[model samples]
Target: MTSTSSTFIAGLEVGHFTDPRRPTGCTVVLARQGAVAGVDVRGAAPGTRETDLLAPTNLVERVHGIVLAGGSAWGLEAATGAVRWLEEQGVGMPVGPARLPIVPAAVLFDLLVGDSAIRPDAEAGYRACQAASPATPAEGNVGAGAGAVVGKIFGIARAMKGGIGCASVTVDGVTVAALVACNALGDVIDHDTALPIAGARTLDGLRLLDSRRALLAGEAPRPLIAGTNTTIGVICTDAVVTKIQATRLAQMGHDGLARSINPVHTMSDGDTLFALGTGAAGKAPGMMTLGAMAAEATARAVVRAVRAAHGIDVAGLKLPSLAELGRA
Candidate 1:
């Protein structure tokens, strides 16, 4: 596939951490006009804000901004920063003589990645919002994805690095894109091996365990087998959709997770997907086409997160990548 450079978003900016699993705060501007949006939570362990708007039944209502941050529940505080910044910039709904930016936000667990005490705060959020201005948003371990990881089923000792990933597809002139920060109890498979792209391997790069057998015999460990975990992201499209429709689409988007992960949305995982309408609605991509794009893009995003990450080795425990594992 040919890599497309990028088109910038005016009201959104992202900041990330160098260390994998650290906090990366972000800010999204509602801009002058409110955008249509929806939310979907499919994880067994979820912590979020403005989730009520995801009801799908009322997505048509305009939303000023969406924030995804790292800090577990604490990360959600970044939205306050965004709210304050947007308000200062007059980006939200007008109330009496003042404008109120309705910024909705989400949080993913990264306490396991960085300094649990170090989380995205309202101040960081404001910086992101203040800096955002029609620029290309950063990706890959940036923003809320700084401390994300995948395939922690074996435990943090072997948890692979995680980060933010993005992919976009075009359908009938309309385009839909997905950006995900995958830190789940599940595994993202290589398109070919059917095994985890982030799996531990032998000296020959062979999988150390029989995940297929584990799945069949039910000895296979899951997040419940491991602990609560989650994967979250956003799906954006040019297609015009009601909030509820987009919410349902976000739910349907979980199908991608089902296809790509081993044990998804487990009690320990807080997998979520938000859907937003750019309103550019380049053309009508139709529901099915856009949905398929979202799923495929999600899978790609998962791979990107793991592949872009660097291995972590601390104390006596060392987590290697597929490359280092090949030489084991």
Candidate 2:
């Protein structure tokens, strides 16, 4: 079940689009008024849009837009469409119509998942804007996750489908939530228990937890090797935070990935996280409090992406969901 946007409901509006043919799409998020934001970078091969602005410590933004798209680096054009729509509505930094609406974005390496030629564009971004709602948002293989894959050690031939996911919890009177698109090179594990949640399943239908082991055992990472690229989208939230704090939050959020994904942020991977605040808090909220909540939520989101996915097959291995395992 999806929840609406409210302080009681994480206070964030969400939207998304999916394409099986392009096998890649996007997820967009918008916050209530007066929300400060930032970002963190931790991927070996990242293709992003509008990250520098999100990292400045002297900036005081209210509520900007967040976009998660497919098309590798080319898909970045999609953001321009979003900015155009936002500028028309006067949503952005305090720079008037000319420079209003500071839209930040991230992209994944889905070039091989779909038509490398059919990249996401301003039209796609416009469509994404039309599709975005300030309420419930779809999850799973829908949106940017449409072309996502996991355990790409063996490359595209061995990876399984991935998608968008979300989770939230209140800590220290502040709601710190997370949403992620997991297309990683390693397995995503349980944050608290350090157990494999979404990684790889063997031919026998058991979890395959180690890629390095598979490689060390003389197993090729993939049937064929591909170029360096694969990205994850992360959004960590709480009460309003400065751009720098938001960036710090994004940095801290990486701790969650470190705990869960083995061989994470590899040279072939482009992992990034964005942090935002809804500006709805009344009392003081420590960064640690928000950081911890963000970490746990991020880990769970990764698991949800896999468990909610379908068509998870590559070569002779199958990555089924908890539903199939009778544990959902």
Candidate 3:
């Protein structure tokens, strides 16, 4: 038997489509049997699709898939491909003669790192769905994390490489898992050690420059640009939850971000989290317990994202990873 992460909820599959042309791509999470979904957008600038319908008051209580992508707003197109793929698989909300798939999506900015013209499109999304698997997805410098960067408070030149990561926590039979694409304006901290693992670098690009402490010391940061940075992700749980409960779970998921990502949810970053309740375990842990696990999983995933990243030099831009800096 193969061992899986405690955060890996049964019956859910993850897939990625990375563009070889550059570090820009998309990730898709499929719940073919459908699952209750909710979302919370904490960042001021967000790029998303079908988010309004996830509100507790909306008619749609479940979503078949969720898409996280890079390439800024244009990456949302990946969700369309996911919808088409689901339709072909005969998985969706039954409505009359049609089986319309509901797939909400969010994207991060990575146009400056490489070829902005070669972003993920509908075909890329379809290919991601084709590669869906139950195994834990690969982390760092793939999918939406391909072009992701962090510690942009000092601008891209001194920023560190960011990537995708997944983590899960379990209490009794209940499990909560998270997958994060780290592209923020600040540093990723180790929640347990209270130390910065990755983020902005010193002027010489040889050491860590804690963004929060720098801001507190009255240091000036780069000019803010909305939607140029973001941290987008998804949360999954095996415990039972209603749509409203899922929304609250997503809100709690931000607690993990606050713990792990310094200067998070700023005006320049569009941090969004989506939650899906598959209820595969038939366990319904108290909201407090479930939320706590969700936060823990999210923070762990955030740190893992940068730790798994690899240094990249492209388009005349060189961003180093934690490994390259000997910080991993």
What is the C-alpha local distance difference test score of each model?
0.65, 0.68, 0.92
Q: Which run of 10 residues does model 2 get worst, by summed lDDT?
A: 1-10
Residue-level lDDT of model 2, residues 97-169, one tens digit each, is: 3646667788887666645787777777767777776554567777777777776675544345667777667
List candidate 2 stretches off by more than 4 Å: 1-11, 32-34, 58-63, 96-99, 200-209, 216-220, 223-229, 312-328
Residue 54, candidate 1: Cα error in Å is 3.0
For residue 160, what is the lDDT in candidate 1? 59
Q: TM-score of predicted model 3?
A: 0.97
Residue 149 accuracy (lDDT) in model 3: 97
Model 3, position 314, has a per-residue lDDT of: 96
TM-score, per-candidate, Cα-based = 0.85, 0.85, 0.97
Estimate, for each residue in 54-118, the C-alpha lDDT of model 1 and write its tens digit. 57564337677777777778878888887887788667777898887777777777666545777
Candidate 3, 1-328: lDDT as tens digits: 1124633578889999999989999999999999999999999999999999999999999999999999899999999999999999999999999999999999999998988898888998999999989788889999999999999998899899999999888788788889999999899999998789899999889899999999999989998667799999999998999999999999999999999999999998899999999999998978999899889999999999999999999978989999887443
Weakest 10 consecutive residues of candidate 3 by summed lDDT: 1-10
Task: Report the CA-based lDDT of candidate 2 relative to the real structure.
Answer: 0.68
